[model samples]
Target: MATFRREKCTINITGTNRAVRIAGASGGFSDRQRAISSLARLDVDIIVGDWLSECTMTLHGAQKMENEKLRAEGRLMEQPAGLFDPTFIENLSPALPDIARKSIKVAVNAGACDAKLLARTVENEVKRRGLDLKVAYVEGDEVTDVVNRLIKGGEKFTSLMTGKDLKDWEYTPIYAQCYLGGAGIAEALKNGADIVVCGRVADAAPAVGAGMWWHDWNRDKDFDAIAGGLICGHLIECSAYVTGGYFFGFKRLMDGCANLGFPIAELFADGHCAINKEPDTGGKVSIGTVASQLLYEIQGPLYYGSDVTANIEGVVMTEEGNDLGMTAIGGYQAEFHVYICGLDLEAKAEWVEKQIRHSAGDAAKELSCSKFSLNGYCPDNPRNQDVATCDLRIFVQTKNKKLVDKSTLDVPGFNRWCMDNGLQGCPGWTLGNDQRQSEGKIYYEYYVSLLPQSEVQHRVVFPWLGGNTLDVKPCANMKVYPRDQPSYETSNPVNLKSFGPTTRGPMGWVVGGRSGDKASDANVGFISLLTIPKIQYLLDEEYKGGKIERFEIPGIRAVHFLLRDHLDRGFNSTSTYDTLGKNVCEYLRSKWVDIPNKFLARGRF
Candidate 1:
């Protein structure tokens, strides 16, 4: 076998300009490691990886908390606690040769808590390999200490959901990291950083930086271009997401794709980009997938980034008035999961749920939200024990952590409640060895809010410059964007009779969209090709939740719905199997909607 390498990167600087192709090499720290090497072998100019999110941040915070406690108890640790995800080095080391060979620039926010360590590690790897590559680390996303000081200096650190100050939060603050823009990333790439590792830079920041560096785009001078890059970056940051990973039409791709292809954004100087994937890959690149990623985890049309507010006005993103305030149920949450296997699964599930709730006694009444969700049913007949299983999830959210914390003597612990019913449970009763559920280690309230650009102090560390730093300033001429953009005058009427003949079918057959969370609320942007459509949601009696405010974007022929506070205070607190709200779209698609006969005739649901 011979090593394949590109002679040099093909830059598009001539009159007949070509788009700078940036491949989404990694969606997260845990994404397929082969993505970087695989995409680098293709015609990509730059490879960008995203590694931070609220979920990951919470996990990192938990790790820090655990290690602190262990050190306090004078426990011997093998490796000193890592502020950054060490997986970055694991994911990057094998791909560096290909990346360097292809002359492909790279950026990744694998620096969960420490950019310097990861950046230095990558630089050392390059040096050891004798590769001519520049490695830089973007910093200042970590601001826990700064936040604490500011809190004492009269900064409320108000909850974005409740508008209550951090002081009102019953539990002591764990840590805070601010969301940063692409400015720091762009600076690194422009200053000749072949590889840029970052911490807490926005998910799409890698792509945004690549586009800015490739096009020489100034945020203030090129707002639309910047916004365009922002939107493009948003669309492809989730790797295969916009190319059929969470798509409604996933079955169609299952025929050929063993795995979905990582997304690549075809970046142009004008700001607009075309999203595609490597040819012959498992997934597809279509309007449905692109729109699905666009609507993922988004709040409204005015998509605010630290650098610029990218308005999705013409493409039609909007949110009807939300009942969004003080929706955090009890704040602190305690949860436990028990898997039932083999025969009498339902009976076993019932026993666990029943006993867990009953054991709480009087304290159960005080819970803001108590949900016992029976998820995943075992199939009938002819399968192994592993296949014949279902999960019994017990969630308790209350104002006080002690109510859920297993160590507290305040009330009966959820873990104890779950385990005590083991003997009484049905034939398949089982419990996991993980004691954290009982210990209340799985409880945390997630809050999302913005910090000023000045506060973040976005900067880059150049390893080639002997660890010298460069400050990346926010846009000088930033625009004050209005919260609401003009929604297309598409009327979303719920009159089922208006569409003439109707048939009961899964909503998936008629339309496609994406669902994700903005804090606790789930936003599902429903896209349909037809306008003047009459649709109604026929949720059964089992449905119980907050107001679903619906809006329509005639331009894109999409109906957007915000399921206010649907996730039980979002991912960390939510007992739902689909913590990120990624499954909401598919779940809604599975619902039997009154599909117009014309849509059925068209055979494009």
Candidate 2:
């Protein structure tokens, strides 16, 4: 057994002589069986499973509350009594004996909102199977009561992403859970627990704990090591992400990815880790594969966690071995979001852009906004009166939450006002889904805030050890910075006169894209198949959007364009129909663009 002690800002590693190996099993709430089977085949010291995503937490909380209500009402059979990831038991049951025999520890966030209950269930199952596995659970991330108290005390629970307060919201939160760190998991491991379960801990916390326990690293003194572990946890937390699962060039791995092997990290004491996979398993681990996962769902260079901050801006990725890559991270925020919905209208992109500029109160002031065609109708052929309408979707974000709320709520009023002007307004003036469009529905917003380490009641509970609980707390050295607003700038004008012969076609025919939400903002990245010297014309004339940043990745032959702050307040908080911004890429792809006829002759578009 290894032990770690903190002494005056220094970490002393004792009772350990070598590097540690940790494997990531299931990524989300699916494919547990495959993950467990892979775990059985891999020779790792510990297995970290990530079962909770942002949406899953909310869903599980709602389900748990509903089940509690049913049980209180004496209708116990109305709904099944189970946690969000019940399949975890089914996945781990068959592997429990092997895991116990090999002394391979397990950690997971499968508990969702009920860590104790899930731990008890797993303990009973292990006992019934005559397995001697000790199950420990980590709690105290549930902050529903705290949130309620704060709201009662007049805390607005402002949106860290959009800077909108809770007073402007119409929906009340049913549950609130903070993202705990790996301190409790490390404490449980120290106390000889073989399996650790947690609720709403950071997605990568399990691996971080396993690394800390294996290497005898302290979070306070070994900031670099802990930060490295944090990045390692994130890289492999998604199971196959670091092993070519979600790579953009996935077609290359499709044949070998039938049973994509989960990722494993060889964590060193010096804050450097090597990412790899099980032998004879599918998926490749290379620089590109690792970089793809590193860039996934990340907002910027600074990756903040409850326990430590990982600064990956200067980190370098290089191949260390066949199917292995290595990177180091050093230690370094709180954030929350809100969603507003039911604002729908139809108009041309130019008209919508002008309207947004007018609404912002200054035509010259740069406003963060995005507009996309719903393809509901053809805008180019307005003479086809038989084609009744086209839906032009728009989204905006500002410091004024009340103004946004009012904007959505006053859709009917705006429509009436437009009708008053009659012929003066844009031709074919109309709104979509008139009834639902008039009534804006407030969504329960996600508020991200920081809690002091001293305030977090972290503990480890051993279900097998007479249900004992050991108190623990995360390191207090982490410094969180306040959330800052995203800035936007107009793209440099493009020289369109030098272009040769071209044919107009859907941009999707010649480009590939990926789009995702980042707090209140939505980022969409596009890769052009043909060499595009300048795209400012397309940005200004076709998209009529702002904050366009372009760059190129080495070894990749395409230029990439990132449109920032494009989805307003993002999913669950945005008024647009494409809340998640998933459709933004498709919308961009569907746009008509003039492509060089030479490339079209090559049959590429």
Give the distance in Å from residue 482's predicted Cα in candidate 1 to where it truly belongs: 6.6
List model 2 lDDT by residue over 510-555, tens digit each.
5655555554455554554322223454443434354454444333
Listed in order, each prediction's TM-score against the native is 0.82, 0.67
lDDT of 2: 0.61
RMSD for each of the candidates? 6.2, 11.6
RMSD versus native structure for model 1: 6.2
Q: Which stretches of candidate 2 lie over 4 Å from their true place?
A: 1-17, 68-80, 315-445, 485-515, 518-520, 523-605
Clash pairs (backbone) in predicted model 2: 335-448, 336-447, 336-448, 337-446, 339-572, 339-573, 340-573
Model 1, span 55-120: residue lDDT tens: 777777666666777889988496765778766777777877888887899888888877877777
Badly placed stretches (over 4 Å) of model 1 are: 1-13, 65-79, 162-168, 315-370, 376-391, 396-442, 479-489, 492-498, 529-551
